[model samples]
Target chain A: MVQPGSIVGGLLGFLGKLGASVYFLGEILRQSGIGIARPRLVVEQIHNAGVLSLVIIMTSGLFVGMVLGLQGVDALSRLRQEDILGASVALVLLKELGPVVTALLFAGRAGTALASEIGLMRATDQLSAMEVMAIDPVRRIVAPRFLGGAISLPLLTGVFNVVGILGAWFIGVYVLGVDNGAFWSQMQEYVDPEDIWEGIFKSAAFGVAASLIAVFEGYNAVPTAEGVGLATTRTVVTTSIVILMLDYVITAALL
Target chain B: MDNLIEIKNLHFKRADRPIFAGLDLDIPRGKVTAIMGPSGTGKTTLLRMITGQLRAGQGSVRIADGDGMTDIGTLDRDAIYRLRRRMGMLFQNSALLTDLDVFENVAFPLREITDLPDRLIRPIVLMKLEAVGLRGAAGLMPSELSGGMGRRVAMARALVMDPELLLYDEPFSGLDPISLGVILRLIRETNDVLGLTSIVVSHDVEEIARLADYCYVIAEGRAIAHGPPAELARSESDLVRQFMAGAADGPVPFHYPAGDFARDLAGD
Candidate 1:
């Protein structure tokens, strides 16, 4: 049984270690020339990370848009701001809601998988094997994943935005008998390309943060099943925190 | 005779706890030097330090000058990587990449480090796989392999680079007798055929006695005895005698205390 102060100290130590790990990863990337070499691998990783994540992202997007449309239409109908329905949906999906929700979904699905896969590699000494063969594990393993996430996030966010808006449009205009032209016209007037850009930027940043956290946790995992589980849990939690923080910052800047 | 690897007064510490202190050794070219020790005597650490995986605190490790006899410790990250290409290591576990099949696992280093075409790469990978008797397992994933087969696949991967130096960390740990014989014979044949310098860290005394041209007995963070296996067999040192004979009642006692024994007996 650890003392309460010791627990707090342990938490602080964990945070410090995480910070150092991120710094070390940055150094590895710089040293390995990951930004330049292995472009094809990065593309492959992006396809895997972003495209493979689409089914879940789309599913979540559709349901979320439906729920928001139902609730917002119900509340706004009483206030007689029903003409602002498309603008409200567009605002929520473009600036704040879509990226955050997609990131949370990604953290649960792809993020955990990345952590477990890398953790297993570490546990099995495959990473050490790469070092002995003179192959840079960072370039071969980590860089691809990082690049994949960076590329995938914006693309996935775009998918979320399109799908989400369509779902909201169906609910607002077709299902609820709201004026279709007014909703789209207001959306076209109010929602700039910069709004979409902000959401994408936030999503991309979240993707990079999530990938970094997952890979770091996996690479540093202790040699046990429990350690892999712990790394997965930490990856999800840390990615969620980062996504929420970035969501606020991006929203404030854009709005 | 040229020494393939030379270590002068190597020292290492982990978190300020001394793992090795002032260790010196030489691995001659074209020979197998077996490191025999009980567990936790820095055998693995010594191997890791030699291969540049871990850095030594206070010593110089130099490889032969055939391709620039660089001091391993002074090399930059790129140089270190290039230097590592000249050495091969078979880890305690097979350590085959789970994401790759057998052929791809063997071909991984070549693919990453060289621009060899598929026509060139396929034959080379197949040849290596055939050497380890795993050519048929080329398409199989690592999960499909038995323990011995996994080790063989790892051996193929290690040897694909045609390295000058080979390090085997407890290669005989989890093998059946037939598999052990095959592995031992392969190691001997591979070293002789390629003239590869080899260092095998093992606790398998019988295997070391049979195979090692020269042997070092490590205990208590030091090489307690070092010589030909025959010479070490005749030593009067109690530590060497106890280790060679596999006695539990020697200078190295069991780690458990009397209180633990009493507790075990009382079922507490």
Candidate 2:
């Protein structure tokens, strides 16, 4: 049996990190007031966090949609509803898979990059250099990167949803012999505007959470090679867990 | 001599290990003051305190701001930043922003602090780079520069603001002999020509001897010796002698303190 003392220790450690993360968020919000005034910095990070992750995100979306298409055809053929495969694929992409998978892939690619880059900066004293130069590192560095990731994820989720629907379309209508008209029409009838909005809202929230964790881990990293590696690992782990938890909560409430 | 900085009864600790205890030192205006110590003796920490990067747990650090001495610990964040604007620090790693090229790195402070037109800012940045003898390397990225070149670019960045106080942390460490000679000359020339006070944290006794007007050698949480480099070179203190002469062993032991070496080796 697990010891009670160990359980309490784990709980306390988690709570400590949670508290520190909240304080970090407050600092980012405060600094972002200044950071937003400098559009160029935020735009540069958008390219780092959003634009660079395009290949992996699109590739993963296509494969995931193709898999879903295969499964939906096999399952729906028993009920003679394979014609509605497009509706199932679109609804899944927008309501669940689109935002969820995009965020997971983002944590793997962009989140680790943000964490390691800033962690390396800290290790090499770039952040301290800024402080000595009278530049607030949070305002000048962290906030812009945070804002960039927060802006990019939702947009990436939109792209993922579109690509995923098209992937399913190719497989279901062309390869599997489902009627193309029935496939698209069924999707238009079933997938509501509310479903699309739900995906958008979820993606936005996950973006903020992922960006916050990455920056917080990086900013507070122990200034060593080993420490930076750990922070990068923690960024991906914490972001993936938070995205899943947030997805569940948002889905329950919206449904 | 008019002092540019004063530390009074300063006390600081890192996780129960006392880094500075009742330490006091002064930096004279318009001179290069070298801080010398063995590794891990908090030379860099002292510089951090002077810049308000790290606060003392007790006592005060007062830096001359205009005509008044502002107690660094008493100031708010905005006030500290205002004080820091008049200061510049060259980190041990050179700390050039990797994303920017040489010209932009030198131009960073000016662009951030002032809305100077590009036409005006360009000349000022080029002039500082020219002073550091890197005017032609302006377009190169930081990765393209040699170690000496990187340090020179960082020095130009430090001087671009025309700061009242400049701090160099281990400026001579890992430099080739030619780079060391260039930095030694720059430190002296920069202080004299610009009328700026400099506090250099280094263990390079030869370079400090050539560049500093006065020097402080700190150890065991306090300044153990302070005098002109010539005076320190002639000191009787065993620890100071060990440090100045670059001896391998003396008052600062060569071996780590431990139980019997034989017993430890035998896993007893």
Candidate 3:
């Protein structure tokens, strides 16, 4: 029932609104006095957004590491490059795969949730209520989530990196009969501090992009059930696209 | 009394569609002014414009006087926030935060705006809740509340800041007679107790007639009638007469489809 042109127009409109909101947020933070600078909101958001995504990330990490290990062993065994297995796994986890995959999962799960919650609030006028009471919804609501996702993504990516490496090591050393010490030493030789930094930087950017897209979609949601659904769909699609695009750009620049 | 809120030559548009143009009105301090209008007549837009939620294209909305007065049009977003701190609004559908229980909902603005300790916030939230006769409902989520109860919780939350200006958008809608009486009494009592300036937007003529010290009839994006309710009740205008009498016929058509009416007439 909806046209593709309108959908594209809506997306552009959302981006424009988000740009305006970012400007608005900067103004709000500039003018807010010391009294309302409660760090508890951000702390709460970090806990909510970060800690809540842990189980999913951990589960996905373990399986992804196992699958990558299986595929790496299969391909490397054929090429007689099993000696470089650990370095390959570590490089993939730290450079291109771990942060990107985790971000995609987060965009699907937490990003969708954030959009729906915010969209519902917008639809119901809770944001307007906050404005009327002199409370900045951005400060109280969006900033917390934005900063939370920004902080949490890197932390979660680190968790994913660590867990994924361990899972891959377990698969390589035990399941595939690869030497544990040799595998670890290869990883130590090839993995650099820059690799970790690159992954973390990517995660942080992805987090911000995803959370911002979600919040923007939610804030601009039309006041209807159908609007909420559309906002949720847009949030997921936009966040996923942005995450993938940013991953490519960041990787291209950093590598 | 000096005007609490003054709008001068207000103009607004959305996506190039004209919402209002050259609108002017004055709301006296410490009085309840009811704005009545048909749907799409810019009643809610006027409220939003005055509250700084929507900026006017070419007019000024000034609230209070001297130190308290703030120009709604000129203030930046942050300044508008500070201005909003001195005001409260009860939305048509209550708009209570679903994630929060009644107590937390009432305490939200305080928690966000002030560094008040939990001990202090507790009593303030309870006091506001008590004022709304929802003291017992403080632990309930918004999902558990009836329409009237949710409105009261929203009122409680709105009053937690003890705002100087109170705005109500369709406060009487979806309320039972008893609940309506209670809400009306509470609005009047709270305004008097706080010495608050109140602005109500409502289509309920009887309620507006009973409650408003001054009533403004907005039709077709302009103020068609403005005065005391008694004065407007005596007006000879067809719009006012039809609106006040709740008639289906007058200057306003129901806007039902012609084909549907034609089919009904054929059946008859």
Candidate 4:
């Protein structure tokens, strides 16, 4: 009933895609039940989606933390509160930058890989061949990749959080000559367990969201070269937007 | 039950164009059948319908399983998967999993569907690879394979499940003459030795004549001719004759439909 080239038509098309994506997520979760039983499949995918992405995540995390250290010192030194650099950097990273930035990096790094791999499989008739063999591709091919991404993102975020803190500590305590004990002590004191828990929860949510979008875009990608390219592009853009939006909603709700 | 698959009044359309309109055909058990047609004539589409990858828009595509004839359109997703286990298809592109090496590719269905241990799987995989004359290439990845070797490996994989029915989509499209002969022999030998019914969709008129027991030439969504390969070659219908002879001008014109050449040349 929706008319083409009209405002309502565009809205309906978007809603239709959103609805299909949600349904695709449900299918992935359902197939994950089967995928989990075969741990090797999921584990192999974890290596592909998670292990392969470590270099970028860690590298970006270190740089982001160093930047935060320099910026935090510059801004707080004006108020003569530079001694509290440890507390502020730790708070910002653990509460916000850690999960959000890691997810953004993960999308660019791992998400695109998942999309392109699955998209190419479709383009090459590999998925259809699986179907012909009575193998459910959602179970065999997609769910493992989705679960791998979901599991790996939080773990990767954890790595980012640790490496980021180390980078900040190196900059603030060693280079800036802040009292080392004060840096460690204040970070431990002011950074509550809730802050760590919030970061963990946000990261886990982002991981699931980002992974779902990636595999969803891939499994449903049109079977062509241009189609696969576009699907890969959509995965990065959609995952980034969704992660940022979820960050706001999750932080607001948790706060 | 003599016929393994029966399609009646099979109507399918892609957007506004009809792909199969009231197409009826029967594939006999324990024989090689060829669905031959020129490009874009829905020969592959018909194969998809029979395999339940696609459904008939109106009419029925029925496959005779143990219970009885089951209409593909009536089956749900799980039902279709269950049905597909008894069917094997060799895709036009070979469709080998790029991640797996040649050995693993042939062993893929067994590993996915059966719990056979490596000890048993090893010999079985090697045997299928041996059948395809590629046992030496088992460890090589798909990227390393030539077009012919890839097709052979795929054929081995298609036969791995010991399926009752096998479908091949354009199996001889791109191959050297020697490779083509190897595949041609493999199709005939496997069909007979395994007691498997095969439906090969291809346009290789000479090749189909040498291999197929029966042939169906489809056009404009219907079977325009059906009989033995020799009988089809002798058909009087202009369309069938054009296809059989590979004629450039006949019912199917050499020149695409256009305005008057003289008028167009003068920029009318």
Candidate 5:
């Protein structure tokens, strides 16, 4: 039967897990510093996490931008401010949707993959083997993946922002009869560099959070098939919640 | 007795379940010491404690380098990692890195621990692979290799560091008779040629008896018998005799405890 005591105990256990995650993050950062010694390793991780993620980011950004253009034209036309479609698209994509969506997709894509890979490594005893060989598996294995994800997400967000802007331009100017002069002039005036930078910064934070969670969950998984599966699930769910929460907190803190 | 590693009154547990209580054992220098016992007797746990992978609950798990002895149970993480560099361990599953090929897997420790160039690393990797008779399989990924080949590759990786001590956890399991003979021979040959201390944790009594110079048999958290393999073969302890003889029925119970089957089925 459920009891108040059991509820309190469960909450305390979750808090303990949170504390452990913080410690694990600290260890990852420490190992990442050692990864600097082997710059090639970090580079390799970046290629996998950042470079491979570009395609989806670009595609999604373009489509989202186009949708924003269509919606802005419809919504603002009633207010007779249809010309501001470019400005609306630019502002929302740069300040909010682009980074958040990219990070969410990345969490689903790269984060789960990272967790599963590391979890499998633990189950197979490869991590133990590395420890026995006196090679810090954290430094050699995790640091690279962590650094890679951190570096990957922001760049992916950047590509998303650019491609998204181009898509908005196509729809707002050529496809529709919106005035190109108004579209260009209004966006140029209203969209500040700082707005774009906010998205970039938020996405970078998301990347670190996502990557760290993925690696930690994998590395500390229970060394079983079910444990690996659970870690992968947790990586996606936890990373999405973290990215969304960080987006809000960062926006509040910075803006 | 020139012991390379020693454990004194060691205590370790799995949560509330005690695996070792005041356990003491020694690994002699430049010789093969075997710890043989029934399944779940903590033979592998003893190896992990020596390697500093698992912490002992209490007491000393010490290893001697040329400079001095380091108590594994008390040493900090960095110190333990530094100490581990001077040793090698062969895990039961071979534990070859799935991402890397046989050559890269074997060369991994050397690359991480030393700043040796690829030119130098290549030759050393090849030599170690040749030692294990897996030189031709260097390019094969771990998944592509057979079980015995994986074991050989892992063995090559273990010796690549030229460690002061080599700890083998069930090196003989999951191998055919021929492969088992080959591995047993390789272990003895490698230890003698490299002049390294070795410990093999396994229940394969016949192979261990043929390979191990000194043997210790543990049961239910303590050593039941220990001596030279010849003396251990002639042990007076009933526990030792039953273990060494591989008897089906002994002091060790065959069935796990449960309620009476007839009463349970009737749901009384």
Candidate 6:
């Protein structure tokens, strides 16, 4: 007895939920004023959600840069233009990998944690308890996390790009024996500041999308053990998908 | 006696089922009123409506918060928060924040709702904990404490604001006999000492009959009966008779409604 009407209704329900989530994000931004009231909570969340993601971002970034250098040297050496190894690696990371990959990692690491924390709070009645105690859970609990993510993503991407460049430099100059002058000049000449700024904007936008999705899932999660688990999983999956889709759209528009 | 809370023609539903319909109830000022019912009988919903956590479909829930009776059914978010300061509710399972130690758990309301310094906040938290006979357990984290200790700390937290109306939602649900007795005594003593109106929602007949000054028995979203505790126990209503006597057979069915069990199992 599955009606076509029911299918349409389900779609409407989903759209309604999307609208509500966007409204919730607006509230988060409005209440905290970008964490102006409670800088301490913002800093704590940055330490938890943003700063903690650093080690992995840097490690992955370095390895990816090295792999790109090795592969670029292999291919370009065959063409006898291997002197531009640094240019290839830097262009690849700056234009695409730096923001996109860091965002995906951020989604998995910080996003799931934020959702589960809020979901558990709901299950334990802490949010209702806060409400009854005259405290706004949004202002007290959610706003800071949003601010942390927004501030941290650009900084994290910067670290990733820096470490990645260094790793590529090692492979290009010392390991592969590409001319040092050629590699440096090629990287500086090809990779513009605009390219780096594009990556920053993209990662910062991804931070907003990911953190908002995480908190929204947690705040509205069904109050149970299974519910919290599902919410956490949804935070990672949904944020990752949104990041990838946004990456494509941003690349299309910017480039 | 003045009525502290007044409900008029409450209508509420959940999960496509009616829970409360055209119901009216009242809470007397400075006296304990017990809302007794079987599980899933909307007692908690009533508490939620009173707190403005749950809205009514077609009625008003009014609470006397000093200046006048504010219609909680229609108060906005900020207004509700201000009104909440005059009320305290002790939830089942304590709901103590796990991140904070016992002292901070109790002191949380004061810390968040006011700008009091740590020096002044510390003694008030300790004093409230002393009231609940848990002053020594202040340093213990929520997980480190026993169930009774946790419940006591929650009670301390609920009372730290010196609220006018206190609500307890099955406060003794998981307690052992000793803990239950301690909680019962604490509720009675604290209600009297603080001169606060209190509501206790429970189906534990014997203990509630001892603890409550007045009682209301509800079933299927209707008030089956209500009176002084002793009088309520002697009610002639069929549900009351069965409930008070703890009889196995009653209007409240022992089994859920469904098709023939054997036939369904055999897929006949």
Highest lDDT against the true fold, candidate: 2
Ranking 1 against 4 by lDDT, winner: 4
In Å, residue B58's CA in model 6 sits off its true spot by 0.8
Q: Candidate 2 residues A5-102, lDDT tens each? A: 99999999999999999999998998897655788999999999999999998998888888888898999999999989999999999989999999
Residue range B129-221, candidate 4, lDDT tens digits: 998899999999999998989999999999898899999999999899999999999999999998999999999999999999999999888
**CAPRI band of model 2?**
high
Q: Model 3: per-residue lDDT, tens digit, B206-246?
A: 99898999999988767888899999999989999898888
Error of 6 at B185 (Å): 1.3
Question: Where does candidate 5 chain B have its weakest 10-residue lDDT segment?
Answer: B248-257
- Clashes per model (N, Cα, C within 3 A): 0, 0, 0, 0, 0, 0
Candidate 3: misplaced stretches above 4 Å?
A1-36, B67-70, B256-268
Q: Once model 1 is optimally superposed onto the true structure by TM-score, how far is the C-alpha of residue B130 displaced, in angstroms?
A: 2.0
Give per-residue CA lDDT, model 6, range B55-156, as digits (tens): 988888898867688789889987888888888888887888888999889988898788899999999999999898989889999999878878889889
Assess the local accuracy of residue B29 in candidate 5 as a C-alpha lDDT between 0 and 100. 91
- TM-score of each model, paired residue for residue: 0.94, 0.97, 0.90, 0.96, 0.96, 0.96
DockQ class, candidate 6: medium
Output the number of the TM-score-best candidate: 2
lDDT of 4 by residue, A73-171 (tens): 889889988878889988998889999999999999899999999999999999999999999899999889989999998899889988888888888
Candidate 2: C-alpha RMSD after superposition: 1.4
Q: Candidate 4 chain B: worst 10 consecutive residues by lDDT?
A: B43-52
Cα lDDT for residue B93, candidate 3: 95
The DockQ values of the predictions, listed in order, are: 0.89, 0.84, 0.76, 0.85, 0.89, 0.75
**For candidate 1, lDDT tens digit of each residue in B1-268?**
5788887877788888887777777788899899988888889988888778888899888888677566788878888888888899999999999888999999999998899999999999999999988899899999999888898999998999899889999999989999999889988989999889899999999998888888888776667789989999999999899999999977888664456777789899
- DockQ, Cα level, model 1: 0.89
